[model samples]
Target: MGSSRQCFQRFLEQKNIVTNLLGKLEENTGVYYLPTGSIAFLAFCLIFGYGASLLCNLIGFIYPAYASIKAIESPNKDDDTIWLTYWVVYSIFGLAEFFSDIFLFWFPFYYAGKCAFLLWCMLPVACNGSQILYHCPIHPIFLRQQASMDSLVTDLSGQALDTAASLTREATKAGMTHLQKNK
Candidate 1:
């Protein structure tokens, strides 16, 4: 009976220590607004309520659709180029997310996890994953391929110009010759 009482007291002390440690960590981490345990549950319910979910869905669908239409209609070359690069990266990320969802969707916090990841991607702060991806992988690979395609296009255009010039000269000579003979 004495040993049992000692063990229970030790357990309570350990629980208090852990709770205090977590509270300190949260305070230091600057996430004062972030809820934990029961508060977290309530916050989740409020944030992901039906109306909020519907609004998120609507924005998700509308933004991309609107962007696509605007991209098609816009005449600015530089903006179009920027949008093209963004869409390329976005498409690649979307494909990766599609495959990952097969497993991750089963998790209870999947939507929250996804929202956090996307926020990380969009945030302009240092060490953002999207910025890293754009600079390290997508930018380099896309630029190399684009450079090669640009060179190929330039060569083709040069060849076509030469051919057209040659044809025009030949036609002019033939016309002059015909006129001389008629005279």
Candidate 2:
């Protein structure tokens, strides 16, 4: 708890883009101060029964996608690698979630927990979840399965091409038959 608070404080202290944007909005809105309405809205989303899933999904998708585009545009390869790692981790999580969401959504605070997790995974810190996950279990597992995965993918691609060719031939034959009958 203490470390998390410290990390959040440090994040705020940095006055990064998110904070600066929020601060600017608060200044212009003039309804509430920094973090107050933000915290309230967050808490409301977590506790309320509405829009939580949308919020969580948006958080998981939008920022990382924007960052990925930025990474692609920039000259540095480091951010590119980082964004790629993030996408890898996110894809894995999405696959796991697909099977588990039926049960997972039963929990009251599931969306909130997921939002926090996505934030953790998206954090710019060295110890972020995406980096840790990509380095450890994910990398090891991929290394072990890469050969089999490659073989499977190659087989599937060949089969797909074969099926596509067969379909095209059948369609052309039908078209020729129809044209002859029409004449």
Candidate 3:
């Protein structure tokens, strides 16, 4: 963990081709700013200003989607588990957000908090938000409700099939009546 943190710090500190290009552009533009200023500005917008929702959603969605795709391709079972856990956590978050979004949008720093939460849930660490929430809260509730949920799903499936069959029969009768009239 310590080594990984050190590696991350080193990565942040290193300046390469992209940094050099941005530096030259800043110099020519007669502006003095750190290479990371753009990121800071973006973060500021996400936290306090307009377009925060869009930015927060992009942060929540794009990276995990890309990571999930890569996880599908990878041979490692652990990465697959990680991505699956992320999706489960994300799904629950989405479900809760769906019901609360109208009111939540009016709250101060909501997008910022959501964005931070999304980032936490997607973090690569072992004890990331997704894993913690799943293990501590979600898994137990799922266990308790699994049987009831299965029964409800079964009932719904049967009803759906019955409805589809009735619809098909009605459509067939209509088609037959039209064909008979033409004949």
Candidate 4:
């Protein structure tokens, strides 16, 4: 048994497969330096195995709730705006997830997939969820609407100014004629 276990370990190390897999998992979950055969790893496995729903609830409900309350109390305009935008985008994501679940729930690794997606969305690193949604869709739409509104305002203001100038010229001519008649 000992010899076979040693051989398996050697094979895993030689291929570097286990190490790479663990590294990727740690990168996504933010749980690093957890040895595979250690008690902590076993505990993590057990908790996640049975308490995945609970974990999802905490992440989905607790964090957002806390962040929203904190955002309201925050004095920094930029920070508040960032938090509010996150919530708006996240809400849209939630709606998409709801529709996706009808098909995705049939998969064996649905929960794991969902957790990975949520992590990607929330992670502050490059190509993260919030950044993708904001830059790809939300920001562009806002920019287009703002540009259209600005053009409309400019056109309306120009027309108003021209009308005012025409009225002023007519009023001045009438005043001069009245003065001449009085003389």
Which scores higher on TM-score, 2 or 3? Answer: 2
Candidate 2 Cα outliers beyond 4 Å, as residue runs: 1-17
- Which stretch of 10 consecutive residues in model 2 shows the poorest summed lDDT? 31-40
Residue 35, model 3: lDDT of 45
Q: Report the Cα lDDT for residue 120, model 3.
A: 89
Per-model TM against the reference: 0.37, 0.88, 0.82, 0.46
Better of 1 and 2 by lDDT: 2
lDDT computed for candidate 2: 0.87
- Alpha-carbon deviation at 114 in model 3, angstroms: 0.7
Q: Which candidate leads in TM-score?
A: 2
Q: Give a tens-digit lDDT track for model 4, residues 1-183.
A: 999578546644553434566667778878655434443443454345667655654555555566567668878676566556667677787788788868865676555656556655655345667778888998888788998889999999999999999999999999999999999
| Cα lDDT computed for each candidate against the true fold | 0.60, 0.87, 0.85, 0.66
Q: Tell me how far the alpha carbon of residue 71 in candidate 2 is from the true structure, in angstroms, after superposition.
A: 0.9
**Lowest summed lDDT window (length 10), candidate 4:** 37-46
RMSD of each candidate relative to the true structure: 17.2, 2.2, 4.6, 16.5
Backbone collisions counted per model: 0, 0, 0, 0
Q: Global CA lDDT of candidate 3, please? A: 0.85
